[model samples]
Target: MRKREIVLRWHTIGLVRTGSTNYLIHLEAGNAFLEAANLSLSQKSKHDAATHYVNASLVFKKDDPKKSIQCLTKAIEIYTGKHISATSTLWIGPFLSITYTTLYTTKFSRVIFLVLHLEMGRFTIAAKHHMTIAEICEKDLVDIEQAIRHYEQAADYYKGEESSSSAMKCQLAVAQLASQLGQCDKAANLFEEAGKASMENNLLKYGAKGHLFKAAICHFCVDLINGQKALKTYEECYPMFADSRECALMKKLSEALEQENVEAFTTAVQEYDNITRLEPWITSLLLKLKKTISEEEDIT
Candidate 1:
């Protein structure tokens, strides 16, 4: 009876091992089927094409333009019915157009046509086509001012669409460009408008930068005007700097105005003393002040 019990125990162990192996095999097959199903779905949705193009774009951004172009081409072909999504060609169309434009040479007909139109002074037409190109290229380009202008034109063209943000960005770009051109008044106005728009949009940084630019305009205007009002403007707009020459000059001017001492004021004038020296009108005023001070000293 003991021998029979030992044999039964061995048989039970063998049966348990077989069951464990079968269970593992079933799990492995299930995982394989799941992977195959995922691949089928990816192919059906043309998601693989999107993935390839997006990865290639990333590679291009990382400085491997040639490899990136190759990857993009493969992706374009994959999406264009070579391997996936044969019945539909939606996702790859815009991406291919963008890639083709990026890779276009001067010899390319479209680029040549664009150049000819631009050279012929067809600015409006050229701008329209350039906008198309920019839309395709999207974040692949920089030139903030150019992008802003393109978006502005696009917003105008698509008037029915909501483009308040685009308009505000365009205004900001215009303000920045005007500031660079030293058109302080126009820049200040645009900045103010941008600040208002940004505040409405809950864009804190944009509003702050706008206020900063407005302050800068005030500072520049004050320097040009040179009076008590200008002095007050400078004080109001004083930015954090290690040492600001403009602030120093303003302080010196204010001190000289307060002291009523001709020699001290003249000596305090640094490099900008020429401004006071060359101006006959300012020199006459200074002489009058000096004479008045001298008379006061004499009476004392």
Candidate 2:
């Protein structure tokens, strides 16, 4: 009867959804689960309690972020086995398991926790969490702006930790998004920094040319003179960049942009596309670049 009651409580907790008026009920159930876990010292019960904490946090997120954070912190502590008594985790037997209301309950709770941490100026511990949120935004939610925001924040934190490789990865993600949004100057600077950093790492040096090429393209969107200057600087920094097909393509596109020649740019892009596939993102940026040149010609 006691075990059946426990399972019913777990089921009741799982049924509560976000923004539902059952906030207090879920919180009480979560506390009861924790108490049961402590009394019985069951690992699975602890896990159930942690999951309940996460769901409860989500329920109160908008109304009371502090309380939400408190609940999420408890959930994380339980998940990581911190502060809980070691003996309380003894796996006696699987009694009951409650499926999460949302598949992303844990991930969402962590993201919310770190975002609040960021708002409160606690950046030191947010690097990994921010990166995780960034990936979730990019891959799961398909929110490019949020992904860029989180990636940029992660880059800053990574730089503080002296994790240059990780920071460069974030920079690359932001740069790609910036270029897609036609924020050419921001993209150009980030790509240039990432390229320079890549050139310094023996393992990443081969990929440096691709970064430089993208940077040069972003600069082209800003101005032909800037593009020419950037391409020259890239070649000087990495001699191998000058010998690459990307370098040849950039030179052709730069010449076209300088003369406001749309046909030449289109032909160059087509020739390159025929030899090597240009991904949709690259194709989109190229179209934007071509439009800029066309707009300039129309003005002339």
After superposition on all C-alphas, the RMSD of every candidate to the true structure, in Å, is 22.0, 11.6
- Which number leads on lDDT? 2
Write down the TM-score of every candidate: 0.28, 0.61
Cα lDDT tens digits, model 2, 130-238, are: 6655666676567778779978988887787677888898899999988877789999999988888888889999999888988988898788789899999987878
What is the alpha-carbon lDDT of model 1 when measured against the actual structure? 0.42
Q: What's the distance in Å from true for residue 66, model 1?
A: 12
Off by over 4 Å in 1: 1-57, 64-160, 163-170, 181-186, 198-300
Worst 10-residue stretch by lDDT in candidate 1?
90-99
lDDT of 1 by residue, 178-211 (tens): 4444555665566655544454555553344434
Candidate 1's displacement at residue 164, Å, is: 3.1
Global lDDT of each candidate: 0.42, 0.70
Q: On a 0 to 1 TM-score scale, where does candidate 2 land against the true structure? A: 0.61
